[model samples]
Target: MAVLLVGTVVVLPSPQSTLAAWTATEYGRGSLQAGTVNPPTNLQCSAGVLTPPTFTWTLPAAGGLTRTGFTWSLSGGFTGGGTLGATATSVTVPGGLLGIGSGTFRLVANGPGGWTSTPVTGTLGMLTAILYSCSVP
Candidate 1:
């Protein structure tokens, strides 16, 4: 007669299980659902043919939660740029803050849930150079 031993495997819930557990713990019966901050729309920029440029956009609606603030970022040709706090439906970012020439700007709305899942981004002035270039015949 011969005897054999076998190994058993156990499966565990994924990380997302925490969310479900948290929801149950927080909400009691149902699962907790995370919310998203809406990004500003109607983004536009002034003519950047001159030093610095202006940026404008429509404020995002906060569904039902309170929005804490807005974060604006500028990359390329600028240094040490800052963020702005907003409580208005429309905002116009002056040229001085945007720096000179062209660059990329991203807008994020912050709230209780978190910042916008996907930020809204745009370019100032014009696309000066291509980030990458390849040649093939």
Candidate 2:
């Protein structure tokens, strides 16, 4: 008479590692609040043209995440500015931008993974043209 016994067990599946330990962290690292650039911030032009402006800002609270892209600039002659189109939270003033007299305009608000907030400047008025004459003609 004879008898025999055997036992075996194996399990392995985990060899695709290239340095990974950060699941997803981005609580607070992007800030750019209170970026105002409304009508008549400090604009007073004449003969050159610049009196009809409107640019406002005050939506930089991406703590919850909801700002895809936003960039703007208006210094001097103003040439199309920069990066001012994409999930726009607020963007106007693209009608020739007046005759351009004063300069100073900026805004930045981009959230998610990359995060980016902190750049708000205003004060660019250039659009004055008010000539009305009607003496009972």
Candidate 3:
């Protein structure tokens, strides 16, 4: 039930369904850092008026797991792909992805995981949602 917080990085506590097990992990976690990565915030398009707009965002405050990639998507005409690497803070997607209308975009973080369904402290792994939402005009 304890949130795995390290400095500015904040990993989410276990979901309601996983409480009992997570509670124990919290106590034994020590340095394991087993938990969901908190979402990044403040997604923006620095140059929306131009083709191949550049997207940017503020990374999560805290999560011990290193982000291996980033996935982006939206409800607009765009079908985004995971073209961004772990360290990429900004990227220029294809032209016409961002139409004139406004819509919300989503981005999620990915990392190595031993468990596909869960993130354990055993090694670098697990990612479902470190997915953050953002909007642009």
Candidate 4:
């Protein structure tokens, strides 16, 4: 409201804002080829569950175009595993160096700048055969 004081016109200042606006620049982005590449799906464990564990899975059709390598690991039963080239679709974790009973397995796709795909995991049952399938069959 405005007021006229003794022939003089007076006006009030509007309220001040408490917040301020700022600007920033984007640095990067993340991707998984629409969930088709990293942490390959359709994981399958061969009939060999005794000596060591051999696991395989499917990757995106363009997997070789992006992925550099694959990392596999076995936990729960013991603690052992290794990395393989992108050309290979399966991994055979060495005997936990010290293992027993059932266990768990994990896999991931290796990428640049500490980039890794979502992990694929599964339970590992007890060994059923003396001759492992990863190395022999």
Candidate 5:
């Protein structure tokens, strides 16, 4: 009589398989999980109605994985500053481009994964116009 011993072999998942499973869970066939970015806060303008004033604000945190860029505008109108990468937390508005008088500047951050938050509005003072003029006879 001959006796044979059988051992059980266990197979571990490959890195690719593990990654694929993670991908399927995180980003299934339906859609990828994305995050919305918070609007910039604590807006501030330098010099008050000064030309080439610097605008600063606290950087917003991403609601999910990551945020892509920030869009700046004036009174809901897009400014020439264009889209800024996530690294940027502030931007300077040229006096000429800002025009004259008082206006509201808005900012909203967006993520590449399809997320855009409500825009935050901030007021800026411009010294462009003369408040009053006097004439002597």
Candidate 6:
């Protein structure tokens, strides 16, 4: 009489199957561009008491984003006291806010994606004399 013995073996998958199943991938990043704003040139004031001085400016091209808005600062004791249009590139200083003194004024434009343009400064002064001359009284 003869006796024979056989053995069988089984293999199991790794416990980290979910982590190994993920594959590597490549991704691209977007770029944020900057924009610019033209400074106000040839500023002039009016003699009329309630008339405000007007300042004009040109909008510069933005790389690939839209212009959000603009901020203005005045010198010569001038105060900004008006609302600007959504796309307005011009502003007028109230009569009562001007004629205080002579100084510099600046403006800057805000672009999309938190980008700002170079500030534009100008030599701003009273183009016209005060409406009420103290010497007259």
lDDT of 3 by residue, 28-134 (tens): 43455576644455556543223344567676557546666666655444454454666666655554444444444556766667212121110011111222222
Model 5, runs deviating above 4 Å: 1-34, 48-50, 76-81, 129-137
Which of 1 and 5 is the better model by lDDT?
5
RMSD of each: 12.9, 17.0, 23.2, 12.4, 17.2, 15.6
**Candidate 1 residue-wise lDDT, 1-137, digit = tens:** 99999999999976653443433444356686766777777766544343244456777765734577777776766433445676644334445544335556666777775554357766653333322111111
lDDT accuracy of residue 94 in candidate 1: 48
Q: Is candidate 3 or candidate 5 better by lDDT?
A: 5
TM-scores for candidates 1 onward, in order:
0.52, 0.24, 0.47, 0.57, 0.58, 0.49
**In candidate 1, residue 127 scores what lDDT?**
30
Write candidate 2's Cα lDDT for 20-129 as tens digits: 58889778777776433221122222222322444555454434455666766666666556664434444455546545355555666655555656666655555334
Ranking by lDDT: 4, 5, 1, 6, 2, 3
Q: How many clashes in each structure?
A: 1, 7, 7, 2, 0, 0
Per-residue lDDT tens digits of candidate 6, residues 1-137? 99898989989977664545657897999996543443233333332443444556766553434566767776656666333443776765555556745555566666656565576665444556654211000
Model 1, residue 12: C-alpha shift (Å): 37
Candidate 1 backbone overlaps, count = 1
Looking at model 3, which ten-residue stretch has the lowest summed lDDT?
Answer: 119-128
Error of 2 at 20 (Å): 42
Relative to the true structure, how large is the alpha-carbon lDDT of every model?
A: 0.56, 0.49, 0.48, 0.66, 0.61, 0.53
Sort by TM-score, best first: what order?
A: 5, 4, 1, 6, 3, 2
RMSD of 5: 17.2
| lDDT winner, 1 or 3 | 1
